[model samples]
Target chain A: MISIIIMNKTAADIFDEYLAAKGLRQTNQRRQILDAFISVKSHCTIADLYDVLKKKDPSIGFATVHRNLRLLCEAGLAQEIKIGSGKARFELTFGQSHHDHLICLKCGKFIEVFDMQIERLQEKLAEANDFLPRKHKLEIYGYCRQCR
Target chain B: MISIIIMNKTAADIFDEYLAAKGLRQTNQRRQILDAFISVKSHCTIADLYDVLKKKDPSIGFATVHRNLRLLCEAGLAQEIKIGSGKARFELTFGQSHHDHLICLKCGKFIEVFDMQIERLQEKLAEANDFLPRKHKLEIYGYCRQCR
Candidate 1:
């Protein structure tokens, strides 16, 4: 069992409160899965997370990971990323800042970048359209420098 | 069989040239599928298109529509939109100007908007990050007025 310390010292408490607010029970498996997810630096899909946890516990299933991911997003502990209209991937958001992605089409590489001007433009655009803009995702897919 | 005339009068010719370039045979089914796709005003998923075409031509199967969709994308007659990391939807791009979307999560509604400012901001951000932006998508997800 890896004692994964999160960026927020209250990560375990956050998870516990999330489960409590949702009237759900906290299990050993959920703690283990979040630990593994926080350990990885890049984005992860359910299959990727399953592979990581199964090696440690040998009992984690894909569906549990998938359900937990949705919960984590709802709890503001993680964020979902759109890598085209294909396989879904997520990043840990606890103690992490928000940014958009530049994904390489040829090599499946992701580079995270933050730009204040872009964020302002999005808010302005949403206001113009009468969109409440609870959440949004912006992804640029093309050949990265290495692939180019 | 709807004789769909698009912005480009020579759409079939374009398909023919694409097929020839790829060493693929231009078939009647491809033409019919293109006809159905071009006729729709909004975005369409494979199942959405199949349902639309199956009513017109029961002979067309799901796999055939799916395969031709890829060819249409490759041929540059269509553009794919990622509604989050969910199902793939496409729109006819020939002679249509570029735009982004505001999606209603509660009701599954898509509202397209064109903004010059958004486009300019994206180019600037990509340049700042040294990312050559080939293509980009921005989708704002929230409740529409009706759903709200």
Candidate 2:
């Protein structure tokens, strides 16, 4: 819990820095959205995040949440993940190590996972193709243990 | 070239089977769209595919192209890939071995690659977490050799 709080603080600071770099103001609504996003700690669609935000402050409009989430992505504090043809989901990226996702097709649950061997092999594959790899996304779609 | 033609023929057969199973009539428009999709041989956005299609048959409307692409996906002959927050792109999946993508961030080129060892590791990872893994997508974004 302490670590998560620390990470959230850092995430806010990073967002502030990003805003400053882009000459964007640090608005109250953006802060609230960011706080709500960090608190969720799971893959959240725009609707999912808006529900959480609406509970705290009814004035927070859906468009506000939508736009701010895109800003957060541009700030490198969040990532947009698309599963199949569904609506996109946003997951916090700041202070998180590189990981893949195991998504439950039935329940829409996301299991963040990492494997060293897989990472190494990916690096080797990139080198073989002479690609200067930047990042990667791996999503395995199926049933989770509970669903199975 | 001959092999590609054979694979395309099989893809059309599979789509015909799928449509029959679903009680959907095989329309001439759907057949034209599928042929255009199979001939592209690269990741293409809806707009890209529509452009190729319009050149062959100028009467083909964008909405028709879009709807049939969705049908192609449902028929399991195509896959949709989303890179970042941009437009969705479709790729051929039939008659191909399981593979991942190396996408060039600069030129938007896609290199389909498969590594047996990486595939093995993914299976192990899914089993470790008690996941009943189905299909998986791995996309690495980078500067390709030419871009580099």
Candidate 3:
């Protein structure tokens, strides 16, 4: 199993390189959005992000939040999850250590887990179909332990 | 590894039970819809379903297809996939044979793969977060083998 690690300096440097490759400007809004995202560690809707940005700086609009999110998603800085709900949620992308979500139906809690057995099965299935695997998102919806 | 096998009478029996559980009347329209769904052999939007139904039986209204699709989803007879697209496509739901999609950007071809590694990782993710796994969908957007 791959051990989970903190976002170290090397990761940050690589993130900068990713930004440059995407031709994205390292602007104040982008930094603020990323800060708010990291600080608020949970699945967040576009409106939720907008609300958080509003709390920090009153001038940020919903469009900005949506646009920055698309940028972040395009730059491989974040992942978007649609949990059969009304709106989609965005979270930062964690490379290598791939996991899926256990989403709380009521309180909207997200639990991330990593299992190697499932991963091997996925590869085998892909190969059987002659598919070239790329990125994938697996989200499981249910009540959390506390909720249950 | 769980081997893929023919979907036999047991599958249809289960689907029938699901229909009963959902209090849906097993009408000719329902049977025709199921047959049409199974015969299409591709991920389809409601519009696509309607078109197919129209070709076979012109009497079926668009609203009927929509309503039946909703019922099919409620009865767990079908799976709905939302790939950041405005509308949703659906396919018949099989058992725990996990799969992901390789979607074509141009032609909208959805190739399914059962990746055990991803499934296991998803389970571990849910376990780590104390989340009970209920349902999951993994869609990886990219060109298919032929498209690539």
Candidate 4:
């Protein structure tokens, strides 16, 4: 629990540094959005984030939340996950290791997963094709245990 | 060369069946679009496909091309790949075995790749999480040899 708090603090520091580098202001609203985003443990759509923000501060408009989410993505503090035809979901990236997702089609659950073997093989596959690999996105979609 | 032609023909047949099942007319324009789409070996944006279609048939509008591409996705003949902040690219899916992609960030080139070990491990990971996996998408982005 203490580690999680430290992680969130580290994420906020990273975002602040990113904003400073871009000459962007660190507004109270942006801080609020980031806090709400970090508090949620699952991948969330913009609407999902907006809903949470709306409850806490009714004055915050949807568009502001949307723009801030994109800023967060640009800062590398968050990453967007697009699944099938669904709305793009943003998941926290800062202070997190590289991992893929197992998304539940029925309940919208996201299971973060990582495998050293899969990672090595991906690198090998890219190397075989003469590519200097940078990053990868792997998402497996299906029904979770209860949903199935 | 002969095998590629056979594959394109099978794709067209499958698309025709899909259009018929949806109670949609198999228009000449859509056929032309499909042909252009399948002929291109790399993943292409709508603008890329539109450029080819417009050169061949000036009457085909961009909206028609965009609509048809979405239809192709729904029909399982193509899949949309969103990489970074770039425009989404559509690649042919029909008459092809399951494979991932190695995308060149510099030149926008795509290399089709498959590995049995990665596939098996993905299934194992999903099963371990109690997920009934339906499908997966893995895209590795980097610089190809020439670009590097």
Candidate 5:
């Protein structure tokens, strides 16, 4: 199992570059969302991040949080995630920090893990199918140890 | 690339056992939904299936289609799928299916394909983490040949 490590360049750096190239403004609330997202230790929904950010900036709304996250994905600083609950979650990601998820169905808990072997096997499958793969998601769901 | 093969047992057979074991009635509408799903050649969302079913039975409601699809999932006759587009989609799944998706972002198309090597690698990852695996989803997204 690969340990979760912080990226050397933060989401702010990535977003700034993205905004500069795209000619987008980096608003204060957007910055706050980025900070809360960066500080989170695991995957979180928009509401989860908003609860934390709203305490600092009550003016922030759910739609604003949602829009910024969409931008973050376009900027390659975050990725959308789903774990069978029909709600979308977001997680910080880098070009090289790709991983899969182990979700706890009973407790709504998620664990991030990485495996080089799985990555290689996916490349082989895509090649065999003649499909040029850009991105992939693998989520394993079951009762966690504590829940079991 | 694996060829899509029809399952030996029909959805009605699988769902009948499921409904009988649960002491649930197999309604006529439920039967129609199952038929449309069985006839479908690829993954479909509730709206997509509902549209097709409505053409045959104008009385069929979206909620009814959604509910029956949920039951189909409980009976192991169908599997819910998504490819980073937020909306939930579903496909048929026998115990032996064990495939993943290659989604086309440009045209919103999804292709199902399987690989034994990918499955074995996932098992290895789960074992390494002491996770008792239950279910998993892998969706790779990019342009299809036509789109490219």
Candidate 6:
């Protein structure tokens, strides 16, 4: 169990290493924003974030929260999702393991899912089109079980 | 070849059918806009569209163009692509079936590529999560061959 845990990388480790490579100082602001993201595990718009961060630390300005989120997105530490909503939401990005999103239109909830078959199919289709596919995001919009 | 072409759904035919279904008149402006889309072979922004449509018919209004485009999107005759570019682009939904996009950041050129593998994988993932996936769009950002 210890060996397995050691081999696995936590979201924090990935983010810290990314910052180190980019010569970006692990600032308290960044740490706070990152912690907020991990704690609020759902699609969160910038405005939603500003409101939440303001409650936790009144000293943190809206601009600070916004800037940190953008930085996280640019550094590949997070994903900006547009789930048919006008505003963009951010989520933590895990290495090569990427999953598609199932968005509930009614409740505005997002559920993550992964399918190997679809991934392989995309590769084959890309090959036929002479396209060197790199990264792809698949988001499906629908209602959840409770909503349905 | 003619018979086969008739058997398969043409883009314009699909557009006309959708328009009729929605009780939208096949107006000169709408026809012109649809023709402009069919004439071009790539993703287009509303500004890009206004440029083309204005040449064909100088009297067309931007509002009409915008309204018709929205109608087309709602009718499923066209697709609305939102890249991180801030402004959204529209493309006539072709009979080529559903596919993803490869957007060249440097040149601002976009290419459509189909990947069945990725689609299947997403479906499986959605099922596992008990999330009913409805639709998906993948936009990959990178430099194209020409731009590279």
Q: TM-score for each prediction?
A: 0.87, 0.85, 0.74, 0.82, 0.86, 0.77
lDDT tens digits, residues B25-130, model 2?
9987888888888888657889998998888889989999999898888988888887776888888877766689999999988898999999888888999999
Task: List the lowest-lDDT window of 10 residues for candidate 1 chain B.
Answer: B1-10
Q: In model 1, where do residues sit more than 4 Å from their true spots?
A: A1-9, B1-9
Candidate 4: segments with Cα more than 4 A from true spot? A1-9, A17-25, A61-63, B1-9, B19-24
* Steric clash pairs (candidate 4): none
Q: Which stretches of candidate 6 lie over 4 Å from their true place?
A: A1-28, A94-97, A127-130, B1-26, B105-108, B115-122, B140-148
Residue B43 in model 6: lDDT: 68
Query: Could you tell me the lDDT of residue A9 within candidate 2?
Result: 69
Candidate 3 Cα errors over 4 Å, as ranges:
A1-26, A94-97, B1-32, B56-59, B94-108, B114-130, B138-143
Q: DockQ of every model listed?
A: 0.61, 0.79, 0.48, 0.72, 0.63, 0.44
What's candidate 2's DockQ score?
A: 0.79
Where is the poorest 10-residue window by lDDT in model 5 chain A?
A: A1-10
Q: Residue B58's C-alpha lDDT in candidate 5? A: 93
**Whose lDDT is higher: candidate 4's or candidate 5's?**
4
**Proportion of native contacts kept per candidate:** 0.69, 0.91, 0.76, 0.92, 0.67, 0.55
User: What are the root-mean-square deviations of the candidates from the true structure over C-alphas?
Assistant: 2.9, 3.1, 5.9, 3.4, 4.5, 4.6
Mind giving the per-residue lDDT tens digits that candidate 1 earns over A81-106? 75755677889787777888888888
Better of 3 and 4 by lDDT: 4
- Model 5 CAPRI rating: medium
Candidate 5 per-residue lDDT, tens place, B59-103, comes to: 999999999999998998788775555667888775446778888
Q: What is the TM-score of chain A alone in each candidate?
A: 0.88, 0.89, 0.80, 0.87, 0.86, 0.81
Of 1 and 4, the candidate ranking higher by DockQ: 4
Docking class of 4: medium
Fnat of candidate 5 is: 0.67
